[model samples]
Target chain A: MIEVVFFLVFFLFIFPFAISYVLASGKERLNIDLNYTRNPRYFSVSFREKLFKAIIKDSLLKGDSRIEVQMSKKELVKYGKFNDLTFNLYPNHIYVITNRAFRIKKGTAVKKEIYALYDLVIEDDCFIRAVACDGVCKIGNDVIIVRWIDAIKSLYIGSGCSLGIACSTEGILKLGKNNIFTRLYGHPIITYGFNEKEYKEFSTIIEKTIRENPVQLEGFEDKPVYVKGDIFSDDDIRLKNVIVEGTVFSFKNIYLENVIVGSPERRVSVIGERITFGRGVKIYGYIQANTKCGKVS
Target chain B: MAMGGIMILVLKGYIISVSLLCILYALRHLIFAYDRFMGKQKIFYGDIIDDQLPTVSVLVPMHNEEKVASNILSLLSKTDYPKNKYEVIPINDHSEDKTKEIIDEFAKRYDFIKPLHRYGGKRGKPAGLNDALKIAQGEIVLIFDADYLPPKGIVRELAVNFKDPLVGAVMGRVIPVNADKNLLTKLLDLERCGGYQVNQQSRYNLNLIPQYGGTVGGFRRDIVLETGGFNENVLAEDTELTYRMYVSGYKVVYANRAECWEEAPENWNVRARQVKRWSRGHNQVMFKYFFKVLKSPHLTFFQKFDGLLLLMVYLIPFLLLLGLFDFLILFFLGDINFIAPVYVMLIPLLFSGFGNFAPFYEIAVGAVIDGLEKRVRLLPFLIFNFVFYSIYISLGFWQAILDSIKGKKEIHWDKTERFRDKGAAD
Candidate 1:
């Protein structure tokens, strides 16, 4: 009886583990892709840019008078989507590259990555996929971009436009009121009613005054407060009229006005939950906000 | 009578001490499992896209790595990072194989591929890195073992963290390339999952010290150079660097998404040697930095606590081994009345459950989180691995103690054997 009891106990203890061991799956090999790389081209703009460049290169080599290459529906269909009614590509489509200035009609449900050498304009309520323009890009009100836009020159976005994941310009990015965007990059990202000419004039004047007097800004009686090291805070950070040479990290919200983070020679980072930048804030580095980031008064 | 009483008291004290250590470690694993399952994950800076990226120097230290050298080199040369912005430096550290020839061939082909041939030097990973660091032109230095295959975006993902001045170093997730090769590799793959997916990520979420494993990670050039390059004597320069950064008021961030594939040891002999080396080097670091961690003003209370626990991880196995002997001695002597002596048997089960140096629950949670359902069935097999680990760890621990007694300053480096065929390279 004792021997039987011992055997039963041992069996009970070892049965589940043994069964699991036998029936267990051994497909634990991880797939490693050698050529796997995230596309550096935001929204596949490089694809359109390369296509444009290739066409131009071929035209120049052939000495063609007219530098234009048009693909028919058959050719375009190979790339992707097609609109049967309009006989033009739309909705989840591929590339549309052209050298001349182009305009999209109002309320057009356009869905293709476009690259234009000259000016590109979109009328009100037109939905886009992605666009890259060498010249100025004028986006209409209520425009919705599904991906991104890159304008080598000025980019003016109209009011109530949902400006996709990213919108960048080498020149100024002028945004209208209630324009929603996750990321915006430009020389100066300005809001509605802020004229570019006036903004440039105001900025030049401020630069001249700063160069000449180096005067202390308002609410800062202590002149020329320069921080040589990083500023880390576990709480909310509010800085005004200060120059930080290194990164600024705040566990909570950050409010900055008239603050310069890093010089052109050295770039730093600003990390916070919600960052609000007032006027005259110049940053030479990266800015990351967990929740929301905006420009206030 | 008095002598026996003293012996019993000492034995009981040892038992209690071991029990407390097990509980502390078990609780730590429980906390890690719970946090991993429920806590809000802290996001890394991989998604932040910017055009103005910093220059980087990728260092691949090779010691007879001819079998896998070309594989890493070819993959690195084709990365998405601007070719001009990053340079791949493959350090040929006293290779007796065709590693030098292979690296030189790459150098001749690509301008960015600079080969550092170290024929006459103290031949080790640290020594090779020290040589490379002297001539590396980039602001950031990314290191990779010859066996590791980094994705194209890994450089950008790692380099982006340096934008934050407080970030001294960044670590990436390591997955085993040969996970399906054998049972040993499969177990290693699971451990990797638990360590990175659960252990390292939870530490980062809680703002604790996340270890920078030497490969698949990068650090600011100046920060490490300022403190003198990696110590050549330390076998585990990665652990040493991790602690050095933390103790010196710099932070190490873990990029869980920057996953890189590495070839784990395919056989038990290789695994034993690898684990033994880790135990030896890690315990050496423990002895070296245990007091420094306690006194570091940069570390918060919890950071110090976790740092100490991390430092003593290698020594835990040794203690558990001693605890087993203690329990057996008590049982044989007919003195099993001290605080429910049968509980001592659960020490191994409690401490090394379902994971490698992690409790079973943590590994299970990690597998669940990683969506690796079938792999969880192999949890019971880990008991055999625990016994294997305990013996080697105890040996390494004793070796460290002996090294301290002899005041040993330097130890010879033994590289892990590679299983990849020469034809595997592109």
Candidate 2:
């Protein structure tokens, strides 16, 4: 009985503990790299730029001034592969590197990713998988983007478009009416039918009223009316003619009329479940809406 | 006979209370694990692209940190945060080594690199930071220990959270740079993964208090100043700052994607000192802010509950230590009842006992989430860490109690020993 008990203890407790200690004593360690690089938003643009540079530098290339070098299957097979970037792309994946403007024809179905280095314009009723442009990008009406669309410069989308996962731009994003999008990132996003003339008189009147008779909100700092701290409210927040130096957050809805949030030197954010912008609302930073974001007529 | 009966009752009560505390902690860990594994993740502001980023001052507190000062400074100099908008302030607090020379060299090279040399006054990190805060010119202040190596995008990732207005501070994830050094570093890496990836993220997701870790995190300068800067007396100024932010109606956000690397203690002695110091500092903050959190009108019910529980975490181990003695007394007296229903509660209690600060299953879950499944084999080894922590943490608890009894005001800050050579950083 003693021998049997010793064997049981040896197998169950002693063995596992001994193995762990030995492993700890040894020079073995888990593979955890500290320097991990993440892909930037303009990853495709940078990748294409690098590839173009490599191709131009290659002594094997027969052409000197070939801006639009269409690689044959054999050339594609022998292309210089660098890092994770492979030339094993599908036939549908188009690489357009040009100094001049390019246009995707009307009703074109872009089944794979497109990396364009020049100004890009897509015609009406097009279906795109993903597209990244180094310059300005203009999309026509009824276009459907299945994955993502990114542009380095001003991006304009016509009415009745369907933007899939995300539509981001380094510059301004002008989104037309009746567009469907999951996420958008831009500096000063403008929607369709945003007419300055429509609410000019109403905005002037509201601004005058706010300046004359200012009402106090609970979460905001009192006096002088210039908000130094961020404005946060659990309920709907309505601001008129207030210059805010910080971010504004409302859990419910936000209505802004002639309110200037942040400055060129200091950028802030305004976020809410739903947001309605009145005339003369100038935001110098990020803006996000969970449900719906629009401008009042 | 009456005395015997009273003693038995007391023993039973103590056991029951300890068991319940164990259960509560286990439940908390389980909830955090589940929330991280399956629940909808709360998105951080790292994805937001803004050209007009806030002016930031990156503060690096140093004391005889000549070994790793230049590495962090080099990394900070190359950060993606606009050089014109941000500045690096390396606080050299009474370092009687080559630290000053190294910092001065960098200061001369980079215009944005400003070195703050504190030759006198209090010598702790909090005291050093107070001096830096006075000269800081940015709207946002990011703190980094001299040993840490922050990534290029960490500044941008942490700074964007300030746009929330409600967020007073933002904490990033910390990975051990020398995790593969030894068993101790490996274990520390696992603990860190569980702590940040699951515990902190879950707190952020549930709208509870996400702690603002001193390093690899940034906070609004005005908010800290308005709340009377870092308390020079408090050792765990980070935990104190966390509670202060919460009570003052400001929030601290956690960014899981914003990862930085730091060297973990390679030896047991250094690890013990680090734990004891953390425990002492954390317990001090607990005593300081326990009532303040309860009375705060800004916190929700869940926030208050979580905050209180977090404050009492260090004290629980000491209580559990006492409960062990209580259990022995009851067992010797033959007054203990080994009933069937008790076994059901004891299972979870057993799991909680094995992994004290971080439960075994919670660490396993964290490893799985972090794609480090191979490290799960090391879960059994944490039993040793649990015992080690229980002893040292209990000692720290006793130290805190003694300090409270004597109304001790003086602070002694012991910096963790850096194992990284100056050449190793390259």
Candidate 3:
């Protein structure tokens, strides 16, 4: 028993040390592989030549496309440049690539906000409305508007789209290109679902409207829409003057009044006043419109 | 019947000896736990509110340390302390390579750096330090080896503790930076943590003067000169000076917070050389001053006892070995039974487990977490650290015994290899 104890004690201290020593020595031999060295002189020459030729080619193809601007504290502006370029703003810089290909290296931080206006080859074609804004704002690539009808913030109206009177979108609003609306009469508010409880009391008014004119909401059935109260993404997305919201996956010619339209998945909601449909509405979720009919007979 | 009785007596003696060793090992663990884990050692960065910030001279003694010399200079330049209040005096003790050239480049770039080139190869680090001490203009002299990369706030931290007039020396914690590089570095890191975190902290808490580690230590320039600078003849100048400071009625305090990272030996060959030097130096100091410490008029009885204990710590591994051998004899004779006292093994096992594995795991986890969180690439190396370290430390112990037995007392300065960008201004 004593011998066993002795052996254990000896092995405990000595064995670990011996193994470590051998491993360390072996590692020393292996560490040579970690040292990476290329022919620096040859590589440098080739790199410099390639860089010079690329710069010359870029300048010949594009006009002097460099934009320089100074930005003060909290200043925001939009640029409409379509060339390979660099912009050195005060305290920060923004670069836009409108030609061939550009790569933003990983592990590098660009300390400025950038808005890519046009779809270059690398970036996908999508309407980026209010890409950088923190205030009540309206942004569009098309259409002009008059005052008092309600300026829209948080509503993303894409190219060649128009909004009618008495319509207001407050929460996250994403619109696809060439979608038009005719005379939206009430505030269509979209908000987070958790905060929907506070607005649920007001939802009784909507319920009452549906009960009173149940026949008017016929064509609004099964349309994809979002309720104002759902945890959209990670954060609770809330909007005022827009109680309910939904996404229209397929394009439809429609008109209706004071009703909520939602998707089958219940992920999107649309609340509007007096929506009309020119053709048959193929809906996905719950939709409530003022009146549903095949024709006005 | 008489012959059987004689055999039984011998067997019983062997069993008793083994039992005593096991008990001692167990007790050592208990003391280690009480001292290291539950010990009331505060590791906070103290305030440096004093109006007068004294100029500090960082003396780096180098011998063929070309590899790491550039890195040391670069790190020194980036120190968060005021540039005007500090000067780096890198004493190049006849480096055979481009160490002088590297120091010269740094001197040209930074006015605070002065390269003190010694022509002939010095026998050891003390000679180089002594040469640099002549022109050292700082009120406080901080010593760092070529391989050390002191953290930004270290100088200020060490400076704040010197407010106590009676304090002769302040020892900073030296940690292994390349701990994940291999098993050897990992073990060295653990050993360092145990020494700096546990042993040194315990001694400091108990108000006992702990030995100042060579690197990551500071001393009052006046006080160092008063004691005739460093003893060049002694193998371990740091240990010898620490004892001398105690004899002069000055306090040696260990600052657990002020940290500097050092490179551990990458290979066993370098590890063996470094360990042999440390062992020989420690032995020399013990032999030279153990009795002197006891008889000194300045030392208290408690201090004398502590010093003696400190000196005897070097012998623990050897004693443990002997104790194991003595236990083995009785076990083979069948005088002692294992089942009766199974709990005895638990004590040493538990103690050794914590003492060995805790620091290793802590450092490995720390490296991994830091790497994952902070994006430092050295995190993956933690896995192999344990196996590498055990080898280095065990070899160190073996080398210590071998050197002592062979009377190899030559002061050979083993230089660590550096892995920083050479062309950089640092």
**Per-candidate TM-score against the hidden true structure:** 0.77, 0.82, 0.51
Candidate 3 per-residue C-alpha lDDT over A1-297 given as tens digits, one digit per residue, 9 for 90 to 100: 667776775566566555545544422110111112211122223322443344345433554444433333433232334333333342253343332333222222234443332222112222222122222223343332221112223444344433322223323433334434432211222211212222233422232111111222222222312243211111112222222333321112223222343433342322222333322222222222222211100
Judge candidate 3 against the unseen true structure and give its global Cα lDDT, from 0 to 1. Answer: 0.51
Q: Candidate 1 or 2, higher DockQ?
A: 1
Measured against the true two-chain complex, the DockQ scores of the candidates, in the order shown, are 0.24, 0.17, 0.01
| Runs off by more than 4 Å, candidate 1 | A1-15, A18-173, A176-188, A192-251, A256-271, A277-288, A291-297, B43-55, B82-85, B222-228, B337-342, B354-356, B423-426
Interface RMSD of 3: 23.6
- Show model 3 residue runs off by greater than 4 Å: A1-297, B1-45, B297-302, B325-410, B416-426
TM-score head-to-head 1 vs 2, winner: 2
Model 3 DockQ reads 0.01
On TM-score, who's better, 2 or 3?
2
Ranking of all predicted structures according to DockQ, beginning with the best and ending with the worst: 1, 2, 3
* TM-score, predicted candidate 1 vs. hidden true structure: 0.77
* Predictions: Cα RMSD each: 7.2, 6.4, 22.9
- lDDT string for model 1 (B291-388, tens) is 99999999999999999999998998898888888878888988886444346546777776732384678888988987877777887778778889
- A171-206: candidate 1 lDDT, tens digit per residue: 666766666655556654555443211111111112
**True contact recovery of candidate 3:** 0.00
Candidate 3 structure quality by residue, lDDT tens digits, B84-173: 889999998877888888899999999999889999755667888887888999888899988777766677778655544556788988
Tens-place lDDT digits, model 2, residues A171-215: 777776667665565665555544333222221112211211123
